[model samples]
Target chain A: MTNANPHRLFRGGAAPAALPARGGIGLKPEHYQYILDTRPAIGFFEVHAENYMVAGGPFHHYLERIRADTPLSIHGVGLSIGGDGPLDEAHLDRLAVLLARYRPESFSEHLAWSSHGGAFFNDLLPAPYNAGTLARVCAHIDRVQERLGRSMLLENPATYVEFEASTMAETDFISEVVGRTGCGLLLDVNNLYVSCINHHRDARAYLRALPLAAVGEIHLAGHAREVDAAGAPMLIDSHDAPVAREVWDLYAYAISLTGPQPTLIERDNDIPEFPVLAAEARQAEIVMARHAKLEAAA
Target chain B: MSAAFARALLQPDAPCPAGLKTWNGSDPAKRFAVYRNNVVVSLVDALADSFPVVQALVGEEFFRALAAEFARANPPRSPVLAWYGDGFADFVENFPPAAGLPYLADVARLEWLRVEAWHAADAKPLPLAEMAARLADEAALPALRLALHPSLRLLRSAHPVVSLWAAHQAEDVSAALGATDFADAEAALVVRDGLDVDILRIEPGAAEFVESLLRGAALGEAAQTAAPFDLPATLGLLLRSGTIIEATPSGRIS
Candidate 1:
């Protein structure tokens, strides 16, 4: 029988697979063949939406082969959801094309702005948590959701500097965004740790304060440490090494609260062999399993 | 405020944007510097990745400097970084820092063309046999319009950029560069067929022929423009490379 609800068919019927609440690794071009050949057992695979914004090439070819076997997540780095300028309709259109082509299980973007005026800076810059900035961000998110016809997860930014103009707290800002836009949150535990350390906030408190019920996914990555002028350790979200021990602790804590969201280990720079990333993914799974056992006992 | 921050982050000498405050209420200059550093360094790295041979030719330090200057003057307009550096070749041509290396700009241009060819739209090649069958009728040949693959790119430079680029790819770059004759003008035909991007050095006239074909000229007309060139060899190369996407006859075929 034909389903009466076409939206349900579009959302679930066309989706290749659902993201299991376990762990996945960020799919890099370097490890495309390794993943295809081995087809490791993981929850899902995540890719930066911008990387696959092409007509056709090995990127799409390998992604098609991988998507057939595993669930996919399209994480956008260029949406600039928090930008002051209007969202690039052309960029949004390209992203829509990719989303339709892949029909990924989940889509996510950052709360930080990466583009200003007409220039895309390529790095996620911080935004003030004020009413003006909040209104602009909400409108942008609305445009994206309406255009893509899919709910997206907005990630928190790892800030090196906070704006004095921010009248609202970071957690409140994110909560308000979720409250208003109906979008989920991609809680990057590493970014939380980095921002807390850089800005002297309590990571544990920040995690507990966030709207945990809205978290659809989790991200874990490594960070580099450097000192500021006053010799305070400043954590940079480098994503070039293994997930830091502190960030892992926060991930475990977050999972204990949120109860095992889909986690992704992102290693963009200094990418190691496939086995290395797979092992990290396994560690995340182990943490989630421990939490699951605890929850069942309770 | 976001505009000010972007300007400061892009330009090293620009003052820190207003409204920045650190955790301890100290001046946020150092903290803001980190974001600035990340933006400039990452964009420079992107350029390096896009133009590895250019980086190899002009050492890491010089390339980083050049890229930083380019980033400040001309930041990317699109988020697709693969499409970034569209104006890098022009930037290099006028960059005073690269005044000594005149061929550097053309090398950069060749590299940019390679990048474009790599990301160009994919096309299905018309079978050579089918194309040959269609072209069998000599009377309709002049009216036939041949379409090249979207990825096909022809480059011409007064300097031997093709050889220089090839040299940088060799293991002993210094030796390869030393052996190359910089005075010889060169042309290159770049096309992505199957799974690889093939860059072949072609005769100047052959490049003109491909250019004409790309402009929707008939085979006979293109051949006339490419006179004194090896037509048979060029045709064989195009066919072997699988670059012809379609051939449409202007007149009805029997």
Candidate 2:
């Protein structure tokens, strides 16, 4: 009963499930009753699918009693799936009723384009990857993975401005939108340190040409320095303060090139307490237990 | 400028371009006025967090110059900036610099009914002793129908918009504006119940008995249209004022 269609469940190579490579935190409303009374070992909880696209009390009964103690991820910041306008059948029927009620192990959004002729510029903006906006962003990520019958994780956006007809390369338009719609990526390391400091380029060479085996999940937040109408300083990914130390050294070099995955620690605006975001999810679980003791000493 | 003339300078009947010399790389209108001033300061901070009590009754510099002129006459359509100010309390009732606050359009319709009861749509509260033993069984009270609390917000106003929204939550609003009443007349509900956004008020036959059980009537015709207010103290002030968080008798309607 779990086949949600990506051309018949991603034609049998499947993937997704993985996550719990430790470190998680971004469940706010000032930490829902201190994460249901301190059950914080910190390794799973994500929320922001438009802040529980609500329809009841106590925000989905305290997110279904913290989705019966952890392993949830629904991150979507509005599915304007790179809008030029078209894909919004009531925001994909309310994201297929929140992926048929939080069967969320993963689900994400943003490749930038906060709507146009149908209006919505609530920020994120930047899109022009060209071959006619990469076949209109792979026909809007294959009609949003054929109407949320699953497959999502898009992410990669933190641009300030770039488009003189950009001929593909934000890791080849996210490796051709995961080679035409298998869809999965979420990356975000403080949006690769605010798009490599607002486009001078090289957040470790865009984390060495990204596509880390189509990632699946990773985001570490906080940015803001502003200046740009030519006063210089630039930056801005603004998930509002705390997460910096060089974006925690580009999230411990993107968890040592995307190995131990499910990391979060985002702070949507000066929100502190839930033990200061579980001490920034215990500094991303001591950098994923020092990248699992350097991959168990090689 | 061409990336279709800087995305046709964010359209409104596009055209402008006799301007930039270098921009980021300098002049190209200094890199399109820094992505058009961070797209009008992140959509005027998402219509000032979708009207914080109309930016606390128009103050944050007159609601950031009326959210930068109602975001150039209504900009957002729905990249879900929390359902982008559902037509900003009818664009501040035809904003001519907020026509000297006619209770700023019922306090932007009680901040769009607390952003539609903070994005409503979850219910399952039936147990008030199983809705009072199915209202003492008149065959389970005409197969009951009640399911309120998708952040339940009802609101009604003629002016003292909940004491001008509790004198914009007084942490010292010029000493709670010299003892209130600039024009008292109100009705409200605004739910959420367990993460604060409460509100309550009601009473005028308890807003027509919770608008006849939010227009689907029957709790015996919403306690006979809340019999001139006091149907068991408006159903015990809507179940102790969390405006009835859950009630479903007719084979539990979803």
Candidate 3:
């Protein structure tokens, strides 16, 4: 991994404020005009960095205006940080250019891989969690953070299957990667619940194993339920429907551990009217608020 | 594992990658199918976004099947799905099922250009006042050169690509309208007027003259080469559409 151009990506101006400790929502093209026309009071707006990787368009046209007032989270879905091969330097360069243009407050990528053998899978694919793989993942994160000249939050992946070659637990692997690379954790409560249910592990135990102190941001999204072969329960991290009840409970529990962190409600598919999603974001704020009251009383 | 996993993702028939595990000891194939579906469905969705007219022309199911085949064979080399389906027009032209609609390939080409135009670099267009003032000197018209908007793109097709695309934008596209004789050879200009992308049909001769000007030809040389062409009409169209970024006179571009 090489830091081809080790420089700050900011274009100049006062730095944007950090993601506020409140509720935000994923920015979608369908809601761009509506978001601008009726300015919604949300904490921050997160976008898949790949979607804005292009030179220019309405995505930039609206985002430039929206970002002027709102905090932004540039989540990279295509960086393939957990890739077997080296990070895509060209892709990284594009990410750099985009960040330079927007100067987003918070940047993040997944703990999973998406591209391999020069072909981008577009979905974050899983990998075996082992010492050998750990080193590679850490190296990739080091390059990403160093190349961008900023710390990034690495989100936990929502995987359907585990690998036989994995020598360490997922939590241990993630803990080591964060310990080694100095990157922050973006704990996706929905993913935590989905993976735990799929693998028959306790979600609470899994959450407790994580290094909660380094969590910079949290994600809460919807998941679809389906049984795999042999009628075993399986969950797909589909961001279509609203957040499930159990995940919200887990989110409340998560905030109890990490206190009030910036949480984003991601509705990638079947995206509804901005108000519908905004209501969900407000739901997250309620949960955070509930937990905050309990902590303040304590 | 990634190498084999990626290969299996596109080739659905292939066996699941070695060493994949699900906690319950059930077949990992079903679990693996999740990843396969994500990769294939998401890529197809991206193409559907980039080439909506192509999808609308062929109907939803057929388009998804066609786009799925195209996706597997031509999965995006780049992660930016905005630029996916680069070779789709070529692929559709050769596809056996699409042999019934020869114009589709051209329509897809036009649609691909629209995708490019939608995302092309932003540039300020020459104001109508500025363009008029530059062309004020009728004597300097021939030596005048035009710089087009960054998002300006031209597509020429034997089929009426513009009509096919415009018909789809309508709320209700009648079958008669769909089968109408819009087979006349056509050329199109896709440009962004203030943030909205506008697609205008143009005559082939005008298209050629603009194409020549795009190559840095002076107005006189370009118009002369595109003989029997309407120079004033084409220039008016370009100016009215806000396509001209700058109008430089002879030796001024240097």
Q: What is the C-alpha RMSD of each candidate to the true structure, in Å?
A: 4.3, 20.1, 3.8
- Provide all candidates' interface root-mean-square deviations: 1.1, 9.1, 0.9
Instruction: Name the runs in model 2 displaced over 4 angstroms.
Output: A1-48, A51-122, A125-154, A158-298, B1-38, B41-65, B69-96, B99-101, B105-111, B114-121, B125-150, B153-156, B160-186, B189-254
**What's the lDDT for all of these models?**
0.87, 0.71, 0.87
Per-residue lDDT over A256-279 for candidate 2, one digit per residue giving the tens place of the 0 to 100 score? 877677788888777877777778
Per-residue lDDT of candidate 2, residues B1-254 (tens digit): 23453355455355435433322564345444555666667777777876776786667898887776677667777655666677777778888888887888878888788777766764444457766765677676655766676677777777767766776677887666566676777788777655556666776667876777777775766767533677677676666655565556665455
The 10-residue segment with the lowest total lDDT in model 1 chain A: A8-17
After TM-score superposition, what is the CA distance of residue B116 in candidate 2 from its true location, in Å? 4.4
Q: How big a share of the true inter-chain contacts is recovered in candidate 3?
A: 0.88
- The worst-scoring run of ten residues by lDDT in candidate 2 chain B lies at B14-23
lDDT of 2 at B126: 48
Give TM-scores of chain A for all candidates.
0.94, 0.32, 0.94
Give a tens-digit lDDT track for model 3, residues A1-298: 1222233232121122378998999999899888889898999999999889888878889999999999999999999988899999999999999999999889999999899888888899999999888888878887887789888888988889988899999998887777667677899999999999999999999999997877889999999999999798899999999999999999989988888888999999998889989998999899989988898899
Ranking by DockQ: 3, 1, 2
The digit string of per-residue lDDT tens for model 3 on B1-254 reads 88889999999789998898888899999999999999999989988988888888899999999989998998889988899989999999999999999999999999888888889888887888888898999999999988888888999888888888888887777753566576588789999877788999988888889888889988888896544667788898998888888888886563
